[model samples]
Target: MVRSILSSSTENVLEKALGASALRHKIISNNIANVNTPEFKRSSVLFEERLAEALNETKATPARTNPRHLAGHNGGGDFNPVIVTETTTSIRADGNNVDIDAEMASLAKNNIYYNAVAKELSRYFSNLKAAINEGRR
Candidate 1:
């Protein structure tokens, strides 16, 4: 029962989202820190698209010919965020692509997303705790 709760898709997705957002926050902070460095390119984290793809892929039923076949793992199991560097254009004369305004906006957005995910996770745990305690009362 505990394993099932930990492996639930909702919990897994929320955990992944929280992790991705935290990583994104660090990447955005790094980009801002290197904004003045010469030839520095802004780095961004890519996870939502890949997460969506994983989720969609898991929705499909896989053919199993043998009982020993492994179950498909999706969503949080193998989800990894890709860090892509901006190389196409430079917004500054120093060849740095980091835009302070954009980075600030991204930081704000990421923070909001992180907080939302955390709140959801907290609620999930709270519900679980309540369920566990209900038998005592």
Candidate 2:
């Protein structure tokens, strides 16, 4: 009962996204740190595509009238960010594929994305708080 008030599926999904963003931030920072190392293939976290696919799944499920009955597939409930190493390309002579320019660009974009998601999450809780307080007045 308390879980229903504190969060919904949307909130859960946003929290997962924030977690993915934090992980992506760490991975990107690691790549940037190893920019000068030899043959250091840059790594990136892939989350959005998989998350979207999970959320967009349209598989059919049997309807149950009872609360104890079996539940259907949960969208975005099992999604996780995947870390991928770029191993096919090397621009420098040392065979290192860590591109400082591209990484920096990605960092900026990710910062904005993270901030946006955080703001939205904050807004959700703020609305909930407002509603709770309004009931007392």
Candidate 3:
């Protein structure tokens, strides 16, 4: 059914990744903007490790109470990204942790990651659309 397909693990993972990437982009941009501000701490989004752990969680097979019961999928739920500020170290005398060079590099990396996830989501939806249209033709 449409609901099942929309809630598929692949779709959920891609959606979460896109959202996390966007958040990371914003955080990185903020760091860049605060590069000259004193006592500004750089923040980063934590997602990949948590996502991997969620995906690798063990699934318990549900006990079937009826002969006609539908099988349940053990696909993990959507993951939320955590944003943490780096407060342990400061590379400058002003106690600011934002490094322009590092922020720029992170920005570029996040952009690439976002683009890749977006492209994959586009491809997924395109395939779904093609399937829907196939019966019409």
lDDT of 2 at 61: 48
* Candidate 3, 23-67: lDDT as tens digits: 999999999999999999999999998787677652554657898
Badly placed stretches (over 4 Å) of model 1 are 1-5, 62-76
Clash number for candidate 2? 0
TM-score of 1: 0.83
For TM-score, the strongest prediction is 2
In the order shown, the candidates' Cα RMSDs to the true structure are 3.0, 2.4, 3.4
- Model 3 TM-score? 0.83
| TM agreement with the true structure for every prediction | 0.83, 0.86, 0.83
- Location of the lowest summed lDDT over 10 successive residues in candidate 3: 54-63
lDDT of 2 by residue, 26-114 (tens): 99999999999998999999999888788776244455789999887655567789999999999899999998999999999999999
**For every model in order, what is the number of clashing pairs?**
0, 0, 0
What TM-score does candidate 2 get on C-alpha atoms?
A: 0.86
Estimate, for each residue in 7-27, the C-alpha lDDT of model 1 and write its tens digit. 667887888889899999999
Our model 2 lands, by Cα RMSD against the true structure, at: 2.4
